[model samples]
Target: MTFFTFVTRGLTRRPVRTGLTIVGIAIGIAAVVGLVGISRGFETSWQTGMKSRGTDIVVSNMGRGLTPKPFSATVVERITPLPHVAETCALLVDLISVEKADMMIVSARQWGGFSWKNLKIVSGRLPNDAAERAVVLGKTAAEVLGKKVGDTLQLETEELAVVGIVDGGAVVEDGSVILSLPLLQEITGNQGKINIVDLRVTPRTTKEELTRLCAQITGLVPEARAVIAGDHIRDSQAYRMISAMSWGTSLLAVLVGVLGVMNTMLMTVFERTQEICVLLAIGWKRSRIVRMVLWESALLGFLGGVGGVLIGVVGVQLLVTTPAIRGLLEPELNPQFLVMAVAIAVVVGVVSGVYPAWRSSRLTPSHALHG
Candidate 1:
């Protein structure tokens, strides 16, 4: 029989053990796929929301927490006149309980700013004036908060009328509770203090000019940093922590898979000692025996990876549907990440087989023939 056929036969000889090994590796890979996907998805959602709002650059005092630190709203004055800056919108962003224990994002924008232009109303209309005690809910937030256009929503000590329901065109945007900056500031005791500034550049702005503008903004406002909207999340402390935790947890899971695969391969080698000895006696090279064991483990890893991807997909779907995650962001399994996961699994398989393959090669023909 051919070498490939020989490897297949060995694996099939004990289906139950092989199946269990595949399952162990599969669970490991599934954790990598699900956790990493959600973390990456969070970054993408914020970037997409910035783009949808026509924001080209962001200025903020980034902090350890997910939200930026509050800065004086007057900082916008330092940014409006530098070349290529078309408009600037100051915002006060916070996370607080809209209901009992249901903490949610509250996005309060400067009234009549360009930031308000992109909000497409699905029902009702925009608040009449900046001083009006009213708010708008993104479609997802409305569903989560269980409020309609005419409902009175409580915000700390104040109650604001919900005047409109909007579709913000991005997951992060659609999951927010939106209102006028002044109103949020008054209720949250952050009057005249805003945390984020979204900038829109003139149509004629070039890449070099944009870079210059960012540097200029940072230079003028020493307390805050300026970055292109897309790069904002990548540069944040919270994103880095999320990324590190995701990979660290995944690595632990992968190590478990490696140990499981190693144990299974070792057991298989021990059980098939006589068969390996017969091959050696018939002039099969020790290298060939080593290759046989390696091939079997690699095949197991390949199957596990495929199964893991499927499990990860289902897990992410269920996770996103929970109340805590329902409107935060949409998690998607990226093609590039999926391919990388399978590659990792294949490497894991080869590494796992090394010790077992070496042990198989150490079996002598004479010793095995008698036993």
Candidate 2:
């Protein structure tokens, strides 16, 4: 029989054990891919959303750590007149429970600004009074909540009227509840508190001008920081931390799979002791025996890798389709990610088989035959 055929036969000798080992490896790969995929999807969605709205920069309070701090509304006025700045708006962001759903709702407001023009109201109308208890629902939020124009929704202890429904096409806005600044302040009980400020620069603004403007804005409010929204979202410490946590968990899962592979390989070595001895006595070199064992382990890993990719893809799909996660993320299967997963599996297989293969090769013909 050919070398490959021999390895295949060996694996088939215990079909149940082989299948379980492949499954163990697959679960590890799936966990890594699914978790990291969700984080990446959130990042991509946020970046694209801000870019689509022509938002040039964002200003916010520099919190103690990676979390964003809420600052006073006066910060917006301080930034409005900066050089190269054409317009500015502030937002109050909060997470509130909705009575109609089991998930937390992202509630936001445009604090003190000219009529915000980026979003289009497809039905109903925006709040006429800043302090009025009215809500403008994003398209997705309206659909998910099953609320329509003039419908009353309970938030906190207050009954608010849904004044409008809007479509921004950006997942962040489309999935959020928006209200006027004053109304949001009343509900959140943080009067004059705002979390973010969006800035739009003049068309002819140069890079130097933008930098100078940011510096001036920072000078105006030393507690706040000015950042290009795109760069900040992509390279922020918070983003890195989340990605690291995902991979950290993935590493643990990978180790578990590696152990499973090693145990399986060791078992294989024990089961084939007499066969190895026969081969050695018949003049098959020690290196050939090692190669045979390594090939078998690699073949198992290859099958495991294939199974892992399939499971990972399905897991990502389920996460993206779930109502709570669907609004904020759009999980995509990256070709590069798949290739990396497969490569990891192959490496795991090779590494796991190394000690077993060495031990198998070192066994004397007499000892292996007696065993």
Query: Count of backbone clashes for each model?
Result: 0, 0
Task: Please give, for residues 105-181, the per-residue lDDT of candidate 1 as tens digits.
Answer: 89999999988898999999889989999999989888888889999899999999999999999888888889999
Write one digit per residue (lDDT tens) for candidate 2, span 1-371.
Answer: 78898899989999999999999988888877787777777677666666656678878763433335778988877787777889787877654567655563354657445325667889999888777788888888788788899898787788899999998768777777778877777776878888778788999988888877877887788877887877655545676778888889987988898899899989999988888898898889999999988888888777888788889999888776666665665664699888888888888888889999999988888754474
Give the least accurate 10-residue stretch of model 2, judged by summed lDDT. 60-69
- Show the lowest summed lDDT stretch of 10 residues, model 1: 95-104
RMSD of candidates 1 onward, in order: 1.5, 3.1
| C-alpha-based local distance difference test score of model 1 | 0.89
- Residue 231 alpha-carbon offset, candidate 2, angstroms: 3.6
How does each model score on lDDT?
0.89, 0.78
